[model samples]
Target: MNTENAKPQQRFLPPPPGAEYPLMGSAVGGGSYNSHLVAGVLFIGLAAIGAIDWWLVAWIDGCLAIGLLLDRRTMNRKIALRAMPGQMLLYSQVALRAAVHMFPYYAFAFVLYLGMAPVVLPLNFAISSFVMLYGFYMLLRVYWLVHYLWVLNFRWEHAGRTFQTHQANLKTRRSAIQHVLWAFFLGNVGLVVRCSSQVITIAGFEYLRQSLNLDLTQHPTLNVHVMSIFWGTVVVWLATFWFMLQPTFLIYYRVHRTFHSCRPLYDSVHSIHHRGVLPTQLDSGTISPLEFALTEYNLPAGMLVPNWYWTLGQIILAFAGHLPSHDTNTWMKTGHHHLLHHRLFNVNFGLIAREDKRYGSFYCEPPQAASAPEPSGEAAPPARRRHAVAALAGEDD
Candidate 1:
């Protein structure tokens, strides 16, 4: 019996009848619930001992969220390890490394946001909005300066790396309007909303009690109940990174796609962004105010979350996240999806491939691109671009 050419079998045998694996069972599902319980107990215990405050809780929750995310990634890797092809396995390793590299940027953004707390926390609504507007403008200008230097030193060297030859749409009336609105209006509005929400959450409770002339004095347990509600809400909101972040991104994608489809809106507003066909960091802030409001700042959590730090995180994610995708010099290959979107104009609408994959719009590096003529400043017509995308995606003509 020669076994030299035999192919190995990949068997899937079910567990024997009545078999129980308590360790695996606990790790799979019970561990997550147990963590929540432990976290709640720890939070309450710390509060009881005067060892923890809101600031501490915020940092703790962020660290816990990252831990949980990494744990899940480990579990997923274990489950999928045998199924991944060699190339895909290599890609996954690279992606993990890139994430590790990007972590410092997240930390920097966090530190920057924290640095602004002293300046913005004490001001009233009117004064804070003014400050935020000025601060936002300064932030945009500083980033622009950084990108300007980046391009000056590196652009020629990286020219071959760019997706297209078209230049960034700078020094135009459209660019000016986008800069003004994105910096002065949309971002400032979001900042003020977060600040106001924080103030209202803290003082409004006391204000309500005084205004109604009814107190928690009648029932001692009522005070406990009110406090429970307050702390519970805070804990839940703190843990939102584990739950709400993905859905928020999905919602933004849907709204962004919708705005693109609305011709009247696109022609009047959304087109301002599209003008920067080969977007650089300068174009990151070049979006219409209405589009910005409807997309980035549109999340209910932006207005409702009492944690201004969380709101600040959202702002950085919205603005800074756009920069790498818009710039060609980044070694991170994740921007290809968006650079393709800019080129084709009607595909790759989502940040990740999931949405486009489901909607039959995923264009996996068009074949013609290898020998295709140099891309021009003008974008392909909508219908032609859609056809090209459909063809590339292997859909019917």
Candidate 2:
């Protein structure tokens, strides 16, 4: 074979027309390009609020609202994936994906309510209790919505850029109808068992409360004083850290490893993610539906905090903590830890650096010298080169 005369093999090719189905995107990827606008507005809003009332939670709320408004403007730009004809189809897929992510939390919440109902009823707290439960559901919905938007936008932008190049090799596999139906059936059965146990637990609690004569009604209103906030903050932070550890380990041990074990599964499902070996923000949830569900199902487990305000605080704080993990910017260290995982699969399996270190999975190449900026009007590299770069940077076994 005359190697010099032969054509070079192409690693990344564009997807066929109308075949693109990306799972999700992230802020670290170009998906949330207008994040700076939102950040700037928030900084100003927070500064102004601090001048008037430094201790008010309303300041945080006000800044968030302004940031959302500013962020919404970015949506006005024509999003390539969103403009595709199969938007509803794509949304349905995303919806099902979201449902799987949330099913566990919803099931657990229902069980918790049933377990607490007896004690709540005797204290004449039924109405307030239901209201609080309903609020928690609504907050969970909002949190999921925020996550959806972040992933959706990133995927849209990513597909616009790379779908054409990877179209030839990018293949998507939908779960069979029978499998989906079976999953639904199993889910209902599990829910029933969970509810039954909860009912039994509630009975036990009711008996105990009655025997002890603990009048929760006397303390109807929760006293969230300064000391309470201090302790609550401490507890929420520790719990959030704990919640992340197990799930992170499970995803690496089970899902990541499983995909690597099956070539066909990896090609059809996992490869959609690894298509971009150098993962961008958009790469966060771009895996197969099963993988997505497995990795994210436990995310909302933190919402199980009994106190409504504390649960909300945990959600916000946890989200803030995760945002840095996905970030690829050089200034952020946490995201690089995860970026390394994407590059080298066997190592850095945990959520934080310490977990990988503790388990002896941590491995990273020393940081390279910064490259010079692309010249003005210069075209981006071809998809093949880009994928090649990513692969060279993080080659896996």
Candidate 3:
């Protein structure tokens, strides 16, 4: 050991548990799987039965209304008798009310439409066209409705803390490509894989419809009921997957977020998604990631469905778009929604940032946005923390 340098000391650092080694990048991307449709076969079969006898769908819608009322009463009693926070009740009430309200409207419309079935049979494509337009309105209504209540109003545990407190720490830089890739991977792959299962099913249905040339309406006189249930079901299913499948993306994006971090870009676009703190149907995939690769696959791939049915289904999907939980509600109203996630970070789930009204879309802020200045006043992103080095892999001078 004495001579010129002898044997060098062995420097060793064991890898972290769970992950075989340190995760060098901010995010890892490309562990993807296919997802498109799994509901196709079931929907086709269901649509076939419904086409043959529309009464079943009506019965189900009726039963759902009754069940919701019963559940509402149960929760109301718990709130009234036990004197609980009524947190869940607030969201439940709105959702349940919407459910019940939509039921009768749908039923009445169906009955009225049935009456005109004989005459409207000839204009089957036209009927699908109308349904598409109306359904989109319903979806948007639900999104904002959820936003007004649970998503926009709730506060978190560390509600007022900011980035200036931690700015000294994040001198190090993290690889940006990593997180961006991750956003695509989990969301694109994880979610798509699940959704593809459903998409393929619909694609199969499209193939069948083309082969069989089936129509959904029972009126035989109008060229085999021009409206086909198979197409309609695919419309709803694909749109559902498109708008409501962001949990997978958020998971990849939020994989690195912590209660204490110097960089707070997660606060910009992503934090609002986590606002619901506790997730529920009210706070489920509320944000739109439709344009992202994970979802955009619906474009060429989605063309498999009939044009009219697909168009109408997109309308109904418009309703569900905002109905689910979102992280955007806060930014929509005051841009403060995302910061809330930095504070409580775990409580508000149905959060959405409802800003613009027309031609709206799902919004995602990059994870590095903390350093960027906010265009709006009254809201300054909290300063970066020193811990950002360790987490973000630190940028040295």
lDDT of each: 0.40, 0.37, 0.29
List the candidate 2 regions with Cα displacement exceeding 4 Å: 1-248, 251-253, 299-301, 306-331, 344-346, 365-397
* Tens digit of per-residue lDDT, candidate 2, span 1-397: 3332122222233322222223442211122222223233444575586732343224333433443343332344333333222322333454464455455554543344333333333343322333343245345534544553443345644532322212212111111111122222222211221112222333444465566654333344533243454355545545555654454353334344334433333433344344334343223323433343344444333333344443344334333322432233455556656555554434444556664454344544323311112311122234455454444322221
lDDT winner: 1
Number of the candidate with higher lDDT, 1 or 3: 1
lDDT of 3: 0.29
lDDT of model 2 at position 75: 46
Query: Evaluated with TM-score, which candidate comes out highest?
Result: 1
Which window of 10 residues has the lowest lDDT sum in candidate 2?
170-179
Model 3 lDDT, residue 130, Cα: 28
TM-score of each: 0.45, 0.34, 0.25
Worst 10 residues of 1 by lDDT: 20-29
